[model samples]
Target chain A: MDVALDTLKFIDLTTANIIFLFIVGFIGGLVSGFIGSGGAFVLTPGMMSLGVPGTVAVASNMCHKFPKALVGAIKRFRYGQVDIKLGLVMAASAGVGVQVGIKLQNFILDKWGQSGSNLYVSLSFVAVLVIVGGYVFYDAMTADKSGKPEAVAPLALRLQKIELWPMMTFKTAGVRISMWFTVPVGFATGMLAATIAVGGFIGVPGMIYVIGASGLVASATELVIAFAMGLGGTINWAMHGMVDIRLTVIILAGSLLGVQLGAIGTTIVKESLIKFVMGSIMLIVAVSRALAVPKYLAELGLLDVAPGTVAIMDKASFLIMCGALLMGAVIILGSMYKARKAHARQEQEAFGQA
Target chain B: MAHEMTKKQAVVRMIGFGAASAAVFGGIFLFANPLTEIFSRGGMYAALPIATVFLVSYVHGGFASNLWTALGITAKQPAKTLRPTATKRPEVRATLNA
Candidate 1:
């Protein structure tokens, strides 16, 4: 599955590639700005489909991502959704987590070669998506059932009580907890990100459930963590001459627009909707990753699946991946539309009052 | 209210972003061979991507921001009803003491 850089011949940007890049970039940015961890999931595969090598795809994606994340963080900051103190603390710990994650990744790569590495990544993706996404979905549903938004988990409340050393306060996130608690959660998110490319799966929930940040702040803060991780990851991959600038530029062009729109959409919606959207994307993405696992297992000879079965699984995986993005876009757009209508109604009411 | 950008501000942002993006593209196009040669130099190759990431973040990031504002998409003010409170929750006292 690993496409070697030496074998990759640079191709001129075709019109299709250009158009696709812009569209995906916008959508990916929208998802990222909304959920804080979706652009890479789409952009990496999107570029790979265009004859870009895997490393180049990853590198280019990272190259585009940092700036996008930076812009997103700034925009969200203006809306007062970002908790800089908390974001910086988590980001610092996550940096170390990335180093450990890379070492583990290299170890897997050395032991199983490319297929094994792919299997490891895919399995981790499925596992994290299932557990985290499932919990989020279940929580969202139960909250809806109760006719009240889901409260922070009991586990997070207990964790917050420990009063460990170097206690920090995030006023915006409305949490005052020890730095010790945040480190492990941030580290795990980074580790998962190193493996799966979507750290927000862990990062957002970790902040919400573990650190007790509201969904809005948690999602916005993830951008800060993402920027740090992407900056580091880009440098690492670029050194190997793996970054394709054309790919980076193309994706950036679209994501910027999408991210800004996403950030603005947040202001119009209720806080709970953020959780709803995040949980939805996480669950569907879990399904998408789960679909890919059988194919990986088949490659490892762990399962004696048929060729057509493998083909179906591969298609299913890609479809589900696209489904995750589509589902996210639907939620954001639908919520934005509803909010706009409500806003218009309020404006009319105010005019009547005047 | 969405602040309408004056023509001068719009022109300045556009030119700044345009020049940076062009320089990046030009650097890649004209110096492809030399850049690749230096970047693939193993240990030092790390700097190339790092530098480029920063460069792209500044240029492309700026372009994206300005482009969005130019199109009238901007962050909205916080809803008045959702204001934060400085008072600690009473639940914190019981839980923290325990």
Candidate 2:
């Protein structure tokens, strides 16, 4: 398909655009750092709104994502929240999963063209975010009301009991699950990542509810998967000249800092809150993507929507995406600040006693 | 409680790490346009962008890590690690810091 010339043009950088991207990158980084996967769902769409083509926006955002994930993974590793073996195992399979994902995307793009492709991506986003996000939100609520640690899912417990060959134990994540169980999660994660830039939507939840890892370990371990997927995705995108390096670098400037702060945040808060934040953001982002559905439907000639309505919905969707990022930031920062004060109080009391 | 070292020493380390971070960030932006053009040219050139992200991650990521330590925002994991079950994570019942 001859991608139109206008679709790939690198827009002249305006100061306003740069500042906007930096802010988004920072918030996206924050969420990613704290939960181990996110940011790209907003960043990709954020870039496209600024006159970048859809593919370039996706590619450039991806280019920045791996590095940020790497930084977050390293920080979380220091906290012993990382399962290096589990991460590597997941990553290896996710690599293959990504290729399959990309192939599926290309197939859709070839047959359906851009508008159809957009619809497919949007539908996928809505379906996954609503279903998975709803499950996570319910779990968070249950855990919150009880004010206790989450019980391992019955499903994960059963899976662990299977005497499948190549059963593996992840010391950090503290689970002993068969590779058969782990592979699908990794594969699904990669596929979602390729479909939408938010693989953690599946990756993190899959770890918690399916594999029975603690929220802290599950989230931190996600960085490993993100790093692997991001690296592979970026290379594939860059190979096709899809990456706009300027966007990648500019976003990284803010994201690197955001990611580090986020990683530190994981240490200070209760594990359940991670699920809360993840669940809330996922639901909100689903709405954001859902808002765009009508626009795509109009384009596909499947709906009788007016042009003005489509335009309005598109803008609305973008704003909501920004809102999702903002909400995630607010939750993370608020938790961190509270944790710091309590820690300070404890320290001062200890000093007085001494 | 990131004050493992004296404030003065921490200040020096912060400045040192801060400068290194700035230098690397500056270096990337310095060649930003041309480098982007070359890296995005496609084909085998894909490796360049991947490697570049890796380098930037290490340099910038390390700097950010240090920046946090210098600012005294380190994680307090050892306290929680003593608990046998992860389900026993401390109840952070405090509301948002007003």
Candidate 3:
């Protein structure tokens, strides 16, 4: 694999390219900080569009991801939101999930070739995001309407009641459930992550709905899982000599700054806002991926589509993907601003009363 | 007392780390070719890039964290621990009927 990897060309960093990577990195970091996982899904494709080989883009993006996760995990830890034991527990199972995911990917690539693989990935994104993201969004809206910001899923409550073998309690997440239940959620998160680079989409929601962690805890705890998985993934890619250090560093510059602001944001905003933002981004990205499906279908010779139309759809898909990240950033920042203003007003009222 | 830094101290540390981080990035661009050659060699050389990212992240991540605190964009401290505002029921009176 390393010998084969040697032949793939890495892109030169023109000033324009460097600037683009830095800006995308910041937005991606900001989103990841708020939601627990994002940016890589955009960064990998974003890099490739700039003439970077697919493998190099993935490898370099991965190289930056783990460290960023490490920093985020630490920052959130100070706020007492991270559940280290749970994150490690889920990460252990996610490791197995990644292996299975890779096997499935290889199987698809072998059977259908590149175009078929593309279609499969896109459809998976649509199906999973629509079902899961819709549920999360609906839950957020319901919580808002009822004025109950913290509501556990019925499934989680039932699971917690059951007296099963090896029940573990996560103090920070405030969850006591059978270890067996956690495995499936963790495994699914890993599998999704393997299929799509952003496993946090499934991982965070799985923690909230299935494991019964609050949105803040779930999102924060995800950084630990991300750090573990990203580290392993980076090492594997690096061993193949696929990491482009320059791109890794350039992206790192922006993401580090963005992630810290994101971590602070969790402290100021309502927990449900995390779900609202995560769910919104997931659905938008799903649509963006859906738009690319026709292009892949045409490539597979299943649909007779004009080349011009395919090109237009491709650009639309990429633009929508970028829009999803931007939208998440705006929501997070807007909520933060509102919260800060409210805090200031309360302080003034307290002073007046005193 | 030693554990706490004044705002001025924090700003100074942030500046120092920011400069160091910038220097590291500048060095990477200056020695881009040689570093890439050494890093891309698989096997034992894989550690080169891994170590480089870890080192760079430490300095840069520190700078970013300090910059936020210095700018007063810090996390909200939980108020629950400081307040004892749990409301008590009003006292019941056992008086003769008027």
Candidate 4:
């Protein structure tokens, strides 16, 4: 009975640690709510730093994510944003992609050891985030400047014309594309999720540019994918006795509140703001992960650096990651407040006219 | 169409669910040690934690939704019109590529 409990390093829940987890969970959930996929990237690391083992942190984080996602997806679904068929199809393939990703990860870990594995993950994070994040950020800026509605990418239009067999239509997403086209996007999403713990970074953009879903639909549908992935992952982890329920519930308590607020935000802002927020966070996180590259390199004997310097870089990287989350939350709340005020004023003027 | 909830009804439901959520969380903390052991025991016991979160999410998620509504932080009116409507289409069956 106690055998599984004895091996894992579960932290004692002090008042301070609980407060920290709650605050981090809230902000992380807020971002996840707005963009469809986030929270775990910060939550897992935040827990690990609190002395919870890596696997336990991951398991507990997954445990919270699905329910959080279920709530968010439902809330967004009411807003007419979620596309269930699209989400289910992508999730089906994402499930397979996860298995492939895990096998690849095990191979890397075995060949290169911890430091090597860490280096590979960090490098991949930097590469994917910069290339994709940059394009997204640039797109957001240009669209905002032009003051034009979001145009479907030409790539999506071309793919839609392919006349591939078994074509499917996603009503909510307002796209008719080959089911074959969706498989790779979902697979890449799962692969990235297994590697970086935030597949939305790829999944959301993939849906927008490739599958031709609007940003709103893409982000909302992502919640469905997250829910499926989170549930599947939690069940697997639980079988190994890896989930720490205490940590899971405490985070859930805060995230549940934050996610509802985030769902409301989608209604208040323009759809392009979703891209702006997602892109901004991605770019910042890429820099933070990049900083950790040197430390991992030093550990693998590929680079020489003072222990103090490596330690400094590690701390800086974590702080920057936290800052990125905080920045995202601030932008979301501020925009929500401003939009609400303007909306109220408009309503007041109209009432006076009546 | 579903009947719209009055402001008064929103307040009553928010308080009810909030109290229930707090009580559940408090009870868990009260019996923290033994609960943690049983919940993390792997195998059949894994269901305990999964079920617990599902239960908590229902209670807490309900409270959170009502809390926002009571505070007048609800979504904009005519939310259905905010996004584009999906076009009517014929259903397609799943096919595997050779």
Candidate 5:
């Protein structure tokens, strides 16, 4: 029963494509591992550039994501970074959010066609990345300058004080905000995942600012949220026959290894460094999406640009996205290298003292 | 203590899990077309992909962890959570939203 999906055609796996997927998957997994969310923003677009349709790319990425999130979550939980209760509450609401977001995406696809859907995805990427990415970056820079840990956001402190009924406390996160406060963040995470195939851009910050989780706990917990988002999303997209299982499995082969390295990163670096990496990548990815927007707009006849211009824009966008991946790899690997060196030197000193 | 898995033990488990992972990937590629068709059938059959992903994560995740441990890239002396998992299943159970 070798059935083909009508909306998505699987491209032949050339040697290059296989190598590319594994490499990209590793980088994506690494990012996802450290921040508890990422890789999808890169992987989805990465798949699309490799000739997969937008929805198929999203679906395939989602298929890989839940499992990745599961692995990352378990790893971080062992370190006491994940709050299962918080992740669960957020994930439940995120499920509802995913349903709503997917409905809107389908509606756009039906009404406006493929280019429109593509344009919608691109615009969403730019908007979310710019707004959320900018905020996260600002917070990271300010925290770094303060030469102290991320000072608890006063908002988080105040929100925790609300004596609402059913106050939920995450012991690892050391936060006691009400369930009322947590669900909306989860729901929004789901919605973002459905639309852009990524929710951690919002989920991590939401946990930090609104729910009072520290950057480490917030990021680790985001893995749980990512898993929930991915599970619900994969189901929704698969039910529509949009998933390219080939892409999913191939990406998994690389990401599985990358994610472990990334999860180790959290232990090696400061919490502020996580935010900085997360923020820097987000802002750069936003630029990448912004570059692609005009191409989609011109395709829809919303702009009168020449076809060559559109092609150029598309190429530039993909290249820039690749650059974003490179930057992420450099920062992550670089940090890991430095941390390992410091750790070794410390061990050597301790031995000498003994 | 770090789950009592020695570096030597981790290396052995890494090889074991690595072989299992390779087998699974080999099976998928060898039977790619049929696997895709069944997994992408759409409907409650979504479970096919979900379950596959979960299985892959467990097997491959184990490999990655062991690989790291064998390399000595573990957490800093791993301060285990002496506290039990404080919050149980969904927080609403613990919540008193009258």
Candidate 6:
């Protein structure tokens, strides 16, 4: 397939297209603000669906993401959810992880070209989502059964016990662990993020189980890591003239709105709800990526699949990705509504007392 | 309670956001021809997208923040039940040192 590089001409964008990008950006932003990492997964494909080249879509999305993450981190900071120190530490190490991830990605690209690289990414997505999502779901269920609020994992507790040198304490996250443990987890998260673009699945769980951060703090901190990674990636892509600014700005428009609302919604919900939503999205996203595996396998001739079947599978993959975002939106909106009502009732009670 | 901005304040924010967004959109439109031409210049062409992203993040980012405030969707104080401390922690001894 001849990939036309000239397809990225700016005049191709229309007013209607700009409006659509803005709306999508807002929604993507809202989801990220709440969940810490999501908008890129949706925005990149969303732009591609509108005829933007794949690389251009990804590049433009990356360009818009860092600033949006910056905005989100600031807002969540005001809500007292962010651990700037932890986030910065994680980001620093995650940068190295991203370099490693890119090196691995380039190696894969060298060997397999585009299809093989896609296969590797989809497979990793499936593997990580299933393993991590299942564990989170099972944990959430067990916590519910025990009638205990979902607490930090025992692994985190045990890790904290290891009195290694440089016992850094994340006061906001309420954990004291060795910098050794924290750095590795942050690096791994960055590596996975560079590969699949959604590092939160690994980063959040890693923080909870390995580093002992609360779900809220872990998720919020992921935004900072995301900011660092996105900024770095954007500069790399921009150097290639691959970024479509119009597309990026449009997505930013929507995402910014979505992210702020998502951040605010965090104030009203229970910690377990975060786990539940994260688990649910991860599982669904796993299935979505799983749908793409066969197509890649077919391309590699590892399997004999029909072309029509491949096309259908590709569409299914896109739908499942959208489904993941929709599921996330539903959870955030539902929880926010409940929280808002509860807040109003509390205010009314205070008024009555007065 | 929702912060009820006086009519003047509301108008000012509205106009501010509106003008900024318009200017951004207008800038993109006005430069559409030249920007596209420069972007395709290739080689050291990386700066075009980098600079554009920074510009968008600033202009559009401000709009998104103000837009959220206008929508009555703002962060509330942490609940009394989950009032974790927001204090910064002191640095711990390095593992090798300890």
Cα RMSD for candidates in order: 5.1, 8.5, 7.4, 4.0, 4.7, 4.9
User: Relative to the unseen true structure, what is the C-alpha lDDT of residue A149 in candidate 1, on a scale of 0 to 100?
Assistant: 30
Worst 10 residues of 2 chain A by lDDT: A1-10
lDDT of 5 by residue, A192-282 (tens): 8777777888899899888877788888888888887677768888898777787898899889888888888887766687888888988
Clashing pairs in 3: none
How do the residues A1-354 of candidate 4 rate in per-residue lDDT, one tens digit apiece? 123345355778899999999998889888888999888878888899988999889999999999999999999998888999999999999999999988999999999999989998999999999999999888787775333446777788788777677788887787888888989999999999999999899999999999988888899999999999999999889888888888988999999989989989988877788899999999999999999999888899889989999889888998999998999899999999998999999999999999
Model 5 per-residue lDDT at A26: 91
Taking all chains together, each candidate's TM-score versus the true structure is: 0.85, 0.89, 0.92, 0.94, 0.88, 0.87
Better of 1 and 5 by TM-score: 5
**Quality class of the docking in candidate 1, CAPRI style:** acceptable
Least lDDT summed over 10 consecutive residues: which range in candidate 5 chain A? A1-10
On residues B1-98, what C-alpha lDDT tens digit does candidate 4 reach at each position?
25667778999999999999999899888777778878887998889989999999999999998998998888874244433423334568899998
The clash count of every prediction, one per candidate, is 3, 0, 0, 0, 2, 16
DockQ for model 6?
0.31
Candidate 5 chain B, run of 10 with poorest lDDT: B79-88
Per-residue CA lDDT of candidate 1, range A92-208, in tens? 888888889989999999998877888899888878877888777766666643223345567777876676777777787767777888899989987988888888899999998
For model 4, the DockQ equals: 0.38
Candidate 4: give the clashing pairs: none
Candidates 2 and 3 compared by DockQ, better number: 2
Candidate 1 overall lDDT versus native: 0.76
Q: What would you estimate as the lDDT of candidate 4?
A: 0.88
Q: Report the C-alpha lDDT of model 6 over A1-354, residue by residue, as the tens digit.
A: 222335544437788888878777776777788878886777777788888888877887888888788888887877677888888888888889888999999999999989999999999999999999889777656555332334667888778778777878787777778898999998998899889988778988888788877777888888998898888887777777777665666677677778878887777776666777788888998998899999989889899999999899889888888888887888889888888888899999999999
lDDT of each: 0.76, 0.82, 0.86, 0.88, 0.81, 0.77
DockQ preference between candidates 3 and 5, better one = 5
Q: Which digits, one per residue and each the tens of the lDDT, describe model 3 over residues A1-354?
A: 022223356666799999999999888888888889999988999999998899889999999999999998998887777889989999999999989998998999999999988888899999999999999988887676432447667888788777677778787777778888999888998998889878898999999888888788889889999999999998998999888888899999999998889999988888778889998999999999999989899999999999999899989999999999999999999998998999999999999999
Best by DockQ: 4
DockQ of each: 0.27, 0.23, 0.23, 0.38, 0.35, 0.31
